[model samples]
Target: MTGRPRLADVAARAGVSMKTVSNVINDFQHVSADTRARVQAAIDEIGYRPNLSARNLALGRAGLIALVVPQLDMPYFAALAGQVLQAAAKRDWVVLIQQTGGDLTVERDALAGRFPQRIDGLILSSTAVGSAELRKRTDRTPLVMLGDRNYQGAAQHVAIDNVAAAAAAVTHLAELGRRRIAMIGSSPGDRRHPRLVGYRLAMKAAGLPIDDRLIKPVRNNLGEEGEQQMTALLAEHAQDPPDAVFCVTDWVALGVVRALRTRGFRVPEDVAVVGFDDIPYGRAATPTLSTISPDRSAIARLAVDSLQAQFEAAAAGTAYEVGEQQAAFRLVVRESSGG
Candidate 1:
């Protein structure tokens, strides 16, 4: 009781071989039902904790899923990882999360790091690599692309219609008769960057001239930095500030609202503000930020399901019916965006 129980002790207590105990730990379906139950009961009785590293080596599986992301500090990525964890837990899977900080080395390592023998799959929402990198890696191991824009024609991708969603947000603001609309988003160079494309298309379709001054790009999407971006956006339009704004993500919208408050501008009443990714906090913000709500939980569920199905099929030499899946998005209106 003073230390962790060993596998041999549990195996002996269960009247089964240590291999059987190992199979039970890995959730391998090969073990007889009766044997599995007996091992489970023994494991429960002795409170055995299997050594993950050695067990993985023995089973040729790390028994883990790595969620590679740019930064967890951003609410969207953090929320994505949370959803992945929730979904993985339903299938009795454990998750190992790694932040890439948008670095190529870290991102590559996060994927290649699990090669030969590590995690069963990877769910990535990174800015570090492209579809080619994803495609190359998936051939070696199962991979599910979460957020990056380009789909390299290899692994499954789960994402929202960013262009359509951004246009919808802007169209909603325009319908409110807010002529001067501004936007806040992330780095512009990313080929898969959808926010920038969405912003421009929306402005042009609305017959609004593409004013570079009104568009503000940031290095990060944390909620705290929203105010700073908003401040700069306002400064750029100081002579004739925009009557409305469309943020690339909800975190930016939250900050924009805060910045407006600091400057004595009431949301919706002064400058209607719209945001993307209707994260949990979006609904709870003081004014209830109006934004786009992509089916985050569904995305997580599908990604996990795809990886699990592939794993089972490969193990059994049977074909898994996993195909490409996409998450739907809805425009959520609230007090902040004059909806």
Candidate 2:
């Protein structure tokens, strides 16, 4: 019944004082749980939107952060960017995205622009840019390094234990009686190389010989490349193909499945398959993919929380050190791996 629902309106509706509603909005932490719940319900019922712009202006913040990924073409990065945006939304900040194609020049250009001027901070998922190159930057912008590579420099970082996760994937396949398992989809000079090392370690531990032929390297991590590699692998070992395939990513697993079906092999029955990332599509695939799934929510939360902390320190002209933040991952057993 008004132009816009105000804090006073919510206070009146909730039968609480304006100061109590303000305390609830600001999250003062001293408010009673019952009071907080009442105020929140009133806010929801009236669709009362907080003036984040005014808040940002008062705090001298831009209310914006850039989430820069190598490329949106990869489902992993696309999904991650979405998760980061959602996480930022929970903190009342906006997230804009930029694609660098993993090009050092593009990444450098973004850094040179003095981020934190237009935007408050940046979450960079760099593939080509190294920690050394990032170390060269002198700006005090609040930054958090996300997936792909490990940055050992000064800024904040959030990633999964790739080596451990990969080893777990291979170990799962081996435990399922999958001998002659092929690990495919690797690009040279990519952070995913650790996964390869993990695979090798797992195979050796299982007393299985590491056959070079079984370690297929695709031109890219796309599904089509996985399909191509699978075709060649099937033809190369038509008489005696590998019993299982562990792809570096879920996209590649899709292709592996396609190749197997084309060559008339029943999944799990003829050749078990496992893929990483555990993207949503994997769950709905003809044979659900069994793979390593990282806790993206944890990663996003850590990255956002770290950046927020850094920003607060920078604004206060105080010392701030962003430590390494790691997310947990789990091996998901599904139909693809005969689980």
Candidate 3:
């Protein structure tokens, strides 16, 4: 019975040493062109291919990069995942995607142990673990963080200035005569909790009183949670509802619009609204949501660059500074915000 072609047979057919044949098959450049062509011809005839798994084991490199997110279901994280996938593809790198669902314990577990060795490096957008624990867990592996500031680790951090970005959204609402600008967001305890501080700062800067009653905190920032929160906010404001609302995410913005419609509040006419992340659905929503547009593609580019740098530094035994790397976010005016 015919069997799989052996490397020795290919080497014999190519008139080269087994080592030379192996080198040529692995695309190691040291093989002479004449010898490489002969080996290629032999391999073509025999359909011989080197086992990648064995090669990786011998080289002691996993050849994998991970992109970890807090929640896969969230539109913002899903979009971020797409960008990371594209960036990794350009480098011919394999990506391992994991969703931690914003659980601190789960996030910590994901980072602990031999995660660095498991993958060449990781691109993480965490909502749980701060920079301190992350630094402790990642022992010299390439780690590029996407969101959740306060992680001033020695790795690269790519994120938007949530405070500043959120402030801009609130300021825009204020300029439009939105005195009672309500805010909806994830838990205030989250590090990258969008725009709460900025909302307060903008309100105070505009000589508007800061009211705790106007802040709506959701359990998990889930879309349904956003809808429920919007309903509660509207109910509280039944006597005198807010003039405008600023949701922390486009998912919440979608829900907020749903609640607005159910409550019979005409968007932009009776109650204006703005959201962040600018997810695609925001554009097609009934009134089209106005939002802060984060440059997700740019963030992906920066993250990939940083991860490459980190991978190089780790291999070269060099140290890099870990500081804040802010991404650009623009305010996109739409029908909801009176644009």
Best by lDDT: 2
Q: Give the least accurate 10-residue stretch of model 1, judged by summed lDDT.
A: 186-195
What are the per-residue Cα lDDT tens digits for candidate 2 across 1-339?
669999889999899998898788878899999999999999999999878887688678889988888878887887888888889998888988899876878787677654544888888887677778778887667888876466775568899988888889999989988889898876433444778878888999998877778778886678899999999988898788999998989999999999999889999898999999988889999899998899888888889888889898988889887667789999999998887
The residue pairs that clash in candidate 2, if any, are: none
Candidate 1: stretches off by over 4 Å: 1-61, 114-117, 135-139, 186-192, 316-324
List RMSD in Å for every model shown. 4.8, 3.5, 4.8
Per-residue CA lDDT of candidate 1, range 1-339, in tens? 567899889989999998888888878888999999999999999888777668656756767887888888777877888899999977666898888788888777767764434678888876757767665674445677877376755567778778888889988988888888888775445435677787777778888876677777776776667799888877766779989988888888898999998998888898999988888798898899999999889999989988887787787788654345778899999999765
Q: What stretches of model 3 exceed 4 Å from their correct place? A: 1-60, 113-117, 186-194
lDDT of 3 by residue, 220-331 (tens): 7657877899899878878888888888888888888888888788999988999989988889988999999999998998898787777667667787666677889999
Q: For model 2, what is the C-alpha lDDT against the true structure?
A: 0.85
Task: Give the Cα error of residue 113 in candidate 1, in Å.
Answer: 2.6
Clashing pairs in 1: none
Q: What TM-score does structure 1 among the candidates reach?
A: 0.76
Off by over 4 Å in 2: 5-48, 114-117, 187-192
